[model samples]
Target: MSLLFRRPTLTRLLLLKNIKQNQRSTICSKPPKEKIGPVQSTFALCVFAVTLLAPAGWIMHHIPEYRRQGQNTST
Candidate 1:
């Protein structure tokens, strides 16, 4: 299609505008305030810990089975 051969000036202009807006925001915007309320903070920490621990727990649970399989394969 002839449309495919068209120059991307409009697309480039929009991309450049977004980049400039981000630059302005980064330079001008204040950082978010830290949340210190105990209940919210505790809940956040618990969620984060569980998210991290789930994978670790999975790995630990699989290790013994994996080792037993390896032992059987060798013997």
Candidate 2:
């Protein structure tokens, strides 16, 4: 309880110390050596779309089945 209720000044000091010591990292400063082709970009986009939408599509497709099961179980 004492630790949880410690003075605000101490917390502020700790936060300031952390902020001063924090280091930022960049992913990359240079551009890619090779550019991605349009075909490869389109394929990548399609794969990404399928990855994201396949599960939702599966769930939506089976929603009626799920509802029927729920009704049968409740009765």
Candidate 3:
């Protein structure tokens, strides 16, 4: 009974050790990297800025219409 429990624990430890070794080896392998040029960087920035600001721009554009409708309904 004791052997049954101990065997699983030892097997688990061995499996965990193998997983850690594989992870370390994979992480240590490398590849060269490319740099982003100015045009690419500018385009990326424009896309990022538009994504960040488009929602606010849409809401700002619609606020006056919403206010006009609210005024008409109250009157």
Best by TM-score: 3
- Give the alpha carbon lDDT tens digit for every residue of 1-73 in model 2: 5888876798899998887767433345788999999999999999999999999999999999999999999
The predicted structure with the larger TM-score, 1 or 3, is 3
Task: Give the per-residue lDDT digits (tens) of candidate 1, residues 1-75.
Answer: 598897789889999999999988877566778847899889999999999999999999899899999999998
Alpha-carbon shift of residue 12 in model 2 (angstroms): 14
For TM-score, candidate 1 versus 2, the one ahead is 2
User: Which window of 10 residues has the lowest lDDT sum in candidate 2?
Assistant: 19-28
Candidate 1 structure lDDT? 0.91
For residue 70, model 1's alpha carbon misses the true position, in angstroms, by 1.0
Tens digits of lDDT, candidate 3, 2-22: 776655578889999999999
Q: How does each model score on TM-score?
A: 0.47, 0.60, 0.61
TM-score of candidate 1 versus the correct structure, residues matched by position: 0.47
Note the Cα lDDT for every prediction shown: 0.91, 0.90, 0.89
lDDT of 2 at 54: 100
